[model samples]
Target: MFQNQHTFHIPVMGTGHSIDTPIRVAHLGIHSVISVVDDLLCEKIRKHYCSEFDLAYKNIPRSAVDGRAERIKAYLETVHEIVTRKFQEIKELPLFEGNEKDRYFNLLPGSNPLKSAYQFIEHLSDREMRERLIEDLNNKMRPGSIDVNIMAKVDALGTDKDDQPLSSEYSDASAALRGYANSSLSSSLVLSAGFNPRLYSYISDFKDFYRDTSGEIKKKVILKVSDFRSALIQGKFLAKKGIEVAEFRIESGLNCGGHAFASDGSLLPVLLEEFREKRDQLRETFLPMVQSFYEAQGWEYPEVSDEQQSPRITVQGGIGTNGEMERLLTEYGMDATGWGSPFLLVPEATCVDDFTSQLLANAAEKDLYLSGVSPLGVPFNNIRGSGSAIHTEELIKKGKPGSKCPKGFLVSNTEFTENPICTASAEYQILKINSIDESADTEEEKERQKNKVMEKTCLCTNLGTGSLIRLGIMKPTYGRQAICPGPNIAWFNREYSLDEMVNHIYGRGESLVPEERPHMFAKELVMYVDYISELSLLTDPGDAEWKKLVRMQKNLEKGMDLCMEIAESEAYEGENLESLRLTVEKQRMRLADIFQNNLVL
Candidate 1:
């Protein structure tokens, strides 16, 4: 069983999105995740909280103590203080007293008073004892002993020159990893486009650092993967490097917020089922491979108990209802379910401004779409009415197509010059727009190409600044805020308090979510169908396109079959089941029709 009272986790929102989100929610005794992409912000948060917690920065190095290390230390200290204080308060409560137990026993007159009193005292004492031991251990351990987790993106790890050591000034995967590894912070690295050998090498360095300093590897790494294949590949890659993946986090391809990386046509249910079936096989294969690497390296392989050998599998993306949440945990056997987008509505936990929060509340399905706004060239979940999008439009009208590129986190492209420039940079956009060969295509085609070049936004600053802007702590550089909310947000029509959101997650009370929203599975299916429709519009379809289409069609068919199976299951019954079945059937029929029409062509 999990240590936290809450069964679900809050997924990493944005560098600015949920900066202090974990701190706000950790007090509630729930394990939450915070993104460590912005070192400066991390430092600021640390300084602010450290002052609040009255914790001194004596243990950390003078230089690092003011930065990421300090931030992590402060966060951990704050969490510990909060949890310990809460525990102490609970232990002192009247319910734990002997007299209180006897009074409760007397209230139930038919029950044996002695037996009820004994049972109550024994249960209460056992619970208190366990909690006390846990608290003691946590206090004794390092800063990362708290339940809050950190998230690092493997791909977004700052783009520094190959020869230079990774800089913490920019948000890079290696820098974040190295920072946490060097500190007492534990976190998961999200791998989107498969394994990066460069990132693995950095992780190897991290292990070496821990080995040198702590005599044992101190860093516990979790791999956040979109699919099972990515998980296996990344797991094997880590095992080869003699590193253990603490968990395998499976996220829905299109249903997730942030940079939307669709897994061909793989559905979440199918992916989860595949992972459930092959988890043991994966662990069996991984253990020996990892053990061999450690032996060959002349390094000690960390001893993992049988219970800890296999990585825990968790799922995220578009999970709305309490029923859906329970099914994922109980039926699918998921270790945890991630409730992300809905938390955006909870201002106490997440950093959503009144304007953006209202925008999210009023958002419809069409308002939240997968847009080509990310400079990283990934499909980003975008709000159509966002200030950032409007700013980009205004800039285009002024004949300026891109941002100032204040933060060069996404500056990877060097197509136009010797020095690499961000795709979303005004310089890159101007160059790209100017270079478009008008003579080779129609005016309409030229216009389309120009518009495509202008679509990239400076998300590095925009995404990170939403909360700060909303809080009125920072002024908005652009006229609007850019938010990456999943389709699930459309179901929640109003902002909710932290307790209300948590209560809703625990099935204790009704949340603000509307009843008409489709099941998570159905929503993802619809998203895939939308993606397929967009895919079909590609003017020059190549072998890759055909392969992608084939994969999508097959996955669609498989997903529909899974839906039918779920519909017939005891766990899923009622009007929602029929709706899902019909939706899947309709999508399947549409796929058949597309192929049928293609054959005629």
Candidate 2:
């Protein structure tokens, strides 16, 4: 982490968007996360890169024993090899323009001490001294960390070729973990989506997760959480098994891409405040338990140092400008920030096919929306006019909705079927629609219910379709490319080079978004208000649901008041603090309306 030259990292965008990001950016000393959620996608990408590099390509059949783990391991090793090769090439190159070496240095923040030291060495008078410094700088250069992400909830149980249930270790998430665990790269595993008790407990079997007598951890675990409570619970679980959490990556609940795990009206600032106050509790609560576990195994646990005890805290979501990032880092004391959606526009960073890339560029605020298309029943942040959306709509028009369910990684439904199936599968949807039509509900209610049933799209296969198209493994004609970008994608309207985007993030170049775009905090507040309004209108809440709504209202007011204080206090140059002030007042009135007309008082 100290060696990472960049203060921000590219988070896992989707199963495919950033699957190969490490191969693209790691050589530049920029850390990024790859989604290992789709091993088949990773395998295809592996074969593609292997052919490009003239490396041997062997097919690992899905029916082979523990093939999912092996496939992921081989692909990740290939990515690590490619990234190392590129970094060595960059190190060997002389300081020159019109080359990757200059691109790497120029992409770094000018305020970075390494960049400053490199700049200073170029102007030195003594030739021998200058050469020595340059050599030292080159030697100190390190490739960025190649982190992998596993959505814990995506761990659907797997079956063998005989259609019999396999052991829990062969589940989707478990296999991905085993692959990453056995990989040659020494990196971190980011556990996102949600916690799986089995997955957390299984991590104990890997010896790399434990610390040795010498101060070296081959593999560290990072938990991507939405709130402090979740962080504590998940961290404590991992700690009980002798696994120390390397970092806690906090994401904005409603303002992120993919599945928007909206907290119960918990705002980003409020969550960050809780983490900031209780950051030490993570180390305090877990250390003794972890030490005891190590002792039971007859392994010496490293003496805890104040500096090494606490896990690193990072924040990401809806951050489109440098001013917001500066506030997150300086004000909240975040160790790092994650820039995700904006990187989707950087072809040099993310893998978006030409057609999908154009769709992302032309996407307006209205085009990027919170959709209910995910088969997992979570609110998915989606874009309008994506190939998958278009395909789904066309299928409905033809009276044949739902996919054929090729790769059933998301299968969880048991309704109307003996065996579990994906709700988005044709067989399931047809049966569900039949049941909805015969119900005694009114026409309007039936239509609404049917819409909900049909809204589930085949995300398992479609999510990675764009990457296949972009990588030339699949044709664009078979376009069913699904993209899940946060609302921030609406502000970035064009493809950008990797260097240009990094320059924007560091505030070294002109801003990519419009000046009128609201501050990240302001946008989040507005979204929460809108989300509450939507929830209130969903139905007349029962006592239980009504109580939840009331709690949300109170929590929202707390966040609004805090935003008001920040707005009245210090106004950042381009942070649009005034808009935040306006949003607070505007949402107050809307919140009043929800209480008055929608939800019960």
Candidate 3:
């Protein structure tokens, strides 16, 4: 019942985590998203393998790499040419005949195309064979089968600034959108991070440019949101600009990898229900606005089929089991489910070092936590006791706080000068330490702030360098690798092949997930409770603090209620209902304790 053969997508890992992730997964006829924040990393991917499937690139606006826009555009063009040329050669092969040719042309419906493709070229080493096969695909294949798409992660709340001259570009949201807009590629473009009116204007520019060239907006716009409100907000914003969002991608706030933006206690199931209930209202609200915009612009509105008019609802974050995937797609009416952190364990699909992969496979629940490690001041999902953490602590011990500030993607602090500097930079940290008013604050308070500053690691380099170091392509400069696997990863205790991982998603084999971990919904509730507990420690709570507590409390209760409903539902019968119930009750108690002990007094 799937329109496209791919019913799953791999979310963008880190700078290097999923650099060439798409190349590997695409061989399985699965769509994968890659981060283009590091243009250097993009170049590395192009230099390595040639592939004959679509690769999605996630463009972060705060990226500070040199010639970032041009470099990305060039990389896209280079890969496109490589893939196109390879396809042409494959068409001329003698063995590629009749139905076999058709099979190669249409690679999605069989037992993983990647597996078969590799077996077909078994004479060459695994690495060499993949490279050769990618470089020799048949040219007569359907157009757009092998292509690249762009994803823009706009920081709705302006990007962080750095003080170094030309060291960091404030925001490349517009630049990235414009580059892809000007490109000849017809792959889809996704606008992630929340809705930004200014970014929408850039999207408008892309529409105008594309219309001028192709007489229409051929590329589809996808909005990545965490909840229904966000989806509606983004959809309405794009509708005002005469754009219809092709899809609404929903992610779990705390359950996700990378920077965690915990929704105020709202559970994934609840959010999905809201969308399903109001699915018609969303389209009704959007269609008229888009039609009006199109009419005002003197352009004929593009006709969309019944299915295309309504945005597809997809969910990601903490999805561990095939059962969970099925429930999400069937019960929630979700179009597709994203398999992210678990893919990190599959070395074939992600750019993780052997050491880091082993660490991830063996990690416990406590190893993954939300930390203030991101220079962006966001709550980043971090691996505890990582090399980056050790390096940060060592720097503090040596009286040196902050990293060297190379590749300053996170440079957005300006506490020291007119030019913004990175909070994680050694120069800024030293200045900040000297400026601290020791007498004004208590010793404990002063030490707390000092430690926080010292703990900021250079994720810009560490995240991307992990894979490079693992492959012996580059040496670690600032520290060892820093990984950002979601809490769901704790349940997966071993490295898996791409075939095995895909099988796990489709329920083709025994479950790969360990049973000890809490259900995905309950795990999220526990995270919210933990966040509330952390917030309770504030000595002088403000009005905003109280409101945040209330929000968290309300959401946690909502989530707990939903978990109970799931437990009672027939779908989960005999599936460790006792464990699920215990986990939910434990989180419920934790939430209650936060309100009674911390807020009540």
Candidate 4:
């Protein structure tokens, strides 16, 4: 019936020959399966995931529901029946190859319930039924069916208020239900040891159960040890306990919760050094074991300023600033970057190669203007520079009036935020109109022109706040199933639906919250930037650019100083600093329109 069916090859972007590093892009395209730490949460997420996958499930036969163990056993039988039927058919199919079949076969024994199902299926007397089931199962199992690594949250682990591991001991009905699923499900449960550091105290018992009880099953676990040194020490302890740790997450940079900027540019050096040292030591202790690491990239206020700097530039301590990820990939040969922000702003951002060419061009422009320094790494350049470029592309796509971005992309930022480019472009056009041969003494005309342009572009409102409510930017959704720092503009850019972002944003265990006032978060983020700027200036007193940054920050802190009057008289407003800056952004955009082509030169 499905004769015409062919494997749908979603052309993976950012591969080897393309512009950006291929491996990083490839890692993103792969499916990531996750389990919530809370039992109730897990059930909700599981049901949604199952629906997405179209996995077929059956109720236990009426005769099999007399007891808890029997009920559990019946579930195992059903899952086994489902998996076995699928695998047998897959094996006989033309697609069957060496490891291709391996991925489709078997179940871990131990506390894992799938093994029992496998064993029960093994005893079936009807070979014809088995073969038929196998064929049917393969057709149903499908290739992309089990791609995600099974994940579990640590906060949801161990005993409830009564001190009992939810899976091992069931004091509550919710725990009981989850434990049943854990036992029957074929996917490995990722024990997030990092979230619940206290769980490490009980790692021995948990490891024993997985190793001894489910000896035949693949007992892989993701140990989320974020602290670099602590992870190394705990990793050793985990190894001794016989648990196979899959990946480690390093949470060393930026206050993504408050979504605040960092005091250090990226502060990655501190953690990267530790990661390198630990990985080297770890290899000596566990040579053949699979070693994995993820660099946490969360949120920060987009840095927009009048510094004539580069966008996407890596400053001293900023996260997601440098080619650190690329460097790390080549240097340590790591697995993933745990990058969530850049993708949040651009959902189809998985293909890095397509964008890398443009990024290189943008980087080059900044490099030339900033005297060989990349724009992306500049102090306050990122916020508007990156947003403006992205916004420009989105605007053109919407058929809005604006010049193309510097890279000739779009002009809306709607791909990630509102059409800041349109606003900027319009304001700049007005400014030019007012100039009128310069000898006309038209400063009043220019001011009027700028005001008219600002109102038309919605530059008067807080773009960031509007983005949060209107577009669900920097928010989390139920389906995305990832918790990130609050009102996350980066995640919003990643193409996450408003509904999905909202779910994760307000969902249980989320750490970020709005301040009940506009620009509250922005102010906090600015303070962090100020702290970092001051520190950098102190350390590198001789840095001319840094001195300029300190001057700019002080002006921004005091609601604008002498420069504000020179740029525009009405730039300073007591309340809503972001609102005042909106005008400044429009002015900058206007300047770009008049001079962008020749401006960098």
| TM agreement with the true structure for every prediction | 0.82, 0.98, 0.83, 0.35
Q: Clashes in model 2: which pairs?
A: none
Q: What digit string (tens of lDDT, one per residue) describes model 4 on residues 1-601?
A: 0110111111111101111111112211112222221222222222332344466544433233223333333333333344444445545644224343422333121222433433455567797986665555444433221111212221222333564445533222223233434453433333331333344334434322232222232323444443456556666665554444444544323423211223332233334445665564654553222121101112121222322111011111112311333343334444434433333333232222223223322332122111101111112212223332344445434646343222211123232233223323444334444454354556786655444333222111112221222222223221111112222232122343322322232221331222222232232234334354345534444467555555634433343222233233321122233432454454334323423332243
Give per-residue lDDT, candidate 1, residue 481: 77
Best-to-worst order by lDDT is 2, 3, 1, 4
lDDT score of residue 160 within candidate 3: 34
lDDT of 3: 0.68
Better of 2 and 3 by TM-score: 2
Of the two candidates 1 and 4, the one with more favorable lDDT, higher being better, is: 1
Better of 3 and 4 by lDDT: 3
* Root mean square deviation (Cα) for candidate 3: 7.0
Better of 3 and 4 by TM-score: 3
**Is candidate 2 or 4 superior in lDDT?**
2
Give me the runs in candidate 2 sitting further than 4 Å from their true place. 96-98, 599-601
Residues 244-278, candidate 1, lDDT per residue (tens digit)? Answer: 77678788888989888788788888898999888
Error of 1 at 251 (Å): 0.7
Better candidate number, 2 or 4, judged by TM-score: 2
User: What digit string (tens of lDDT, one per residue) describes model 2 on residues 195-229?
Assistant: 89999999998888777667667888889998999
